[model samples]
Target: MEPADAVTPVDPVARIEAGPEGPQIGVFFDLDGTLVDGFTATAHAGDRIRRRQARIGEVTGVIEAAMRYRLGRVNFAKLLERAAGYLRGESLADLDAVGERLFQERVQSRMYPVMHEIVLAHQRRGHTVVMSSSALTIHAEPVAKFLEIDHVLCNQFEVDAEGRLTGRIARPVIWGKRKAAAVQEFCGRHGIALQTSYFYADGNEDIALMSLVGHPRPVNPRRELAAMAAARGWPVLRVENPGKGNHGGLRGVLK
Candidate 1:
C-alpha cells in the first residue's frame, strides 16, 4: 500500500488509534534527532575520546574524515569506513557492551518524553513498531531494546571470524534511499502495508521513506523536511533537546 493521495490535518495519535491495527500496520521512528535529542555518532565519538580508545593520529584521521563528509568531499559510507578503521581488531562483543553502557550513561536521559507517549500509543493498538535508524548497530540496538521496538533496520559492521570488525560495513548503508529500500524489503517480507503504516523522522533525507508511508510525522524536522511537510500538508512535530532549558521541550503543528 502507499500514502494517501489526499493529505489533511489530523491528530497523529488519534489517527493511529482510530486507523488499522494488527501486524500489517508499521509504526517506524528514527532514532537520533527524532526519538532522542542528539546524534548517537557524536556521543560515541565523545566516549571514545574520553576513554582514549584511539591513538592521536587515528582520532585526527576520523575527525578529518568527518569534516570531509560534512564538506561533501566524502560520502557517509567512506566516513564510517575511515572511523571503523580505528577499531579494526576490536571485538563486536566488547563494542556491544560498550554501546549498552554508553546509552545508559549518555543517551538515556536525552529521549523526548512526548515521543515515549507516541510510541506507547502505537504499542497499545498492537501495531508493529520498528526503529529505522542510520546509526550503527552498536548505537541503534540499545535504544531499540530500551524502547521494546520489535524490529531494527540499521548499519552493521563487517566482522572477521573472531567477531572483530573488518573495518567496513557488512551490508548497504542505512541512509536516504537505501534506508527506504531496506524498510520496503522488510515490509514486503513481513506482509506489512506501507499505506497502513506511520513513520516519524527528522532528517531531510528521510523524505524518501516518508513519502511512501501513509502517516508521515516529521518530528523536530530539519529545514528542508519542514518545508516539504508544509508543502505536502503533512503534520510537523518538534521536541526540543531535554534538560537544556530553553533548548528543551517539544512543540509542533499537527495541521
Candidate 2:
C-alpha cells in the first residue's frame, strides 16, 4: 500500500512561530558591505562634521589613517583609536542622535533587500541572528533594532560618568581575528555549536570567522574574499545595486 502524503502548512506567521526542536544554530552577519552598503553612517557623519567646520585636523588625520589602513599599512585597531580621538569629549547622546539621522538618510536606503529576506528566513527557522561588525554602538544599534536582530556583536567606545566619549574603546576592537574570537566567545556562552553555525560576510578581514563557521556565504564580496570563496567552492551572493539599474535582483557567482 502507498503511504499518504504529508502536507506542510504555508502560513508565514505559523512558520515563524514554530520554533525548531533541535539545538538552535547561530547566524552571524557582517554589517558593512555585507548587510548594508559600506560604511554609510560614517560617511554621513563625516559630511555633517565637515559642514560644521569642526575638528578639521582630526578629520584630516582620520582620513590619512583610513587611507593607510585600507592599504594595509597601519594596524586597524590603531586606526580606530585615532578615529575615536575625533569623538573625544563629544556627547554620547549627541553621537547617537547624529547616527540616527545618518541611518535614516544614508544607511537605511542602501540595505540590501535580498539580505533582509535571508535574515527573515533564518529567523523563521528559529536561528539566532547576530549583527556583527566593527561599527560603533551608535551606528550599529539603530540598524540592529530596525532589523529586529536577536543580538549585536560590535565595538563600543568608552564613555565618562556624564556620558561623554573618552576616546577609547570599551572592548578590544572587533575586527579581523578579533571578530572571530568574539563569535567563538559568544558561541561558548550561548551553547551554540560552531560546526552548525552560519556566517555571511563580504570583506577579506572576515575570513577568520568565515573559516570557523560550518556555512560561509559571501555577499557582494571584495577581491580577496571572492577568490577564497571561489577556490573553496562556496556560494557567492551579489545583491543588486539599487541605484545602478539593478533593482531587487540577485546573482550567484562561483557557486
Candidate 3:
C-alpha cells in the first residue's frame, strides 16, 4: 500500500455539505487525536495523580498494559482494565465533576478547529452526530455535551451501591470491533443507514468502524491506519501543527 501522501488533510466540509443530511445520517467521531488534539484521558490521569489518587504500582501497571497493547501482546480490554483499576473506590460523581473542570482547563482548547467545523456542518445538515471511543463517560460525556452530539458509544465504569468505582469496566468494552458493533447497533435502532454514514478517527483500533462506514475519514491517522486508509483510498485529514499529532490515541491513555 502507498503511504498517505495523497491523503493529507483537506477541507472536506464542502463535500460533506453536498451529501444528504438528516437524522438518518450518522456521523461518528473518535474523541482523542481525532476531534481533539491531545488525549483527554491524559488530563484525567494527571488529575488522579495530582490528587494522590493513583498509586505508583497502579500507574506502572497502566503504562505496562499500554505498552503491551501497543505491541499487540495484550488485548485492549486488559489495557483499559489495568488503567481503570487505579480509580477504585473513587466517587463517580466526583470523577464526573473533575472531568468537566479538566475539560474546560485542559481539553477544550486542544480541540482541532477543522474537526469542529466538520461537526457543525454535519449538525447543520441534521445528522445524528455521536461520540464513539473507548474513553470513559467522564472523558467523553463532556465533549459530547459541548459539541451537542446527542449519542455516545464508549466504555463505562461500573460502580457499587454507593456510586463508587468498582475498578471494573461495565460489560462490553467499546473498543476496536466492539466499538464498530455498537455504532452499527445504534444505526439499526435509529434506521440510519451505515452505508451512508461517516466515521472519523485516528487510531488503528478505529479501522473496524472505518471499514463499515461509507466515509472512512482518518484524522491524523497513526501509521497502520494511514496505510490502511491509503490502500482503501479513504480521505485522510491531518493537522500539521504541533500538539495535533496523534498521541497513540485515547486507547493509549484512557481508563
lDDT of 3 by residue, 80-116 (tens): 7777777889899998999999999888878876678
Residue-wise C-alpha lDDT for candidate 2, range 1-255, written one tens digit per residue: 111122322332233345352336888988888778778546555665868844778767878988999899998788878877777898999988878877887788778776787778777677878998988888888788888996999988899999999998887889999999999999998899877777889999998898888767778889999888766766566677755666545654333
Of the candidates numbered 1 and 2, which has the greater lDDT value? 1
Better of 2 and 3 by lDDT: 3
Pairwise TM-score winner, candidates 2 and 3: 3
RMSD of each: 2.8, 6.5, 5.4
State the C-alpha lDDT per candidate.
0.84, 0.77, 0.82
lDDT (0-100) at residue 77 of candidate 3? 81
Once fitted onto the true fold, the runs of candidate 3 whose alpha carbons sit more than 4 angstroms away are 1-10, 242-255
- Model 1 has an lDDT value of 0.84
Ranking the candidates on TM-score from highest down gives: 1, 3, 2
Judging by TM-score against the true structure, name the best candidate: 1
The parts of candidate 1 lying over 4 Å away from their true place are: 1-11, 245-249
After aligning candidate 2 to the native by TM-score, how far in Å is the CA of 159 from where it should be? 1.0
* Predicted structure with the largest lDDT when compared to the true one: 1
- Could you tally the backbone clashes for each prediction? 1, 0, 0
Number of clashing residue pairs, candidate 3: 0
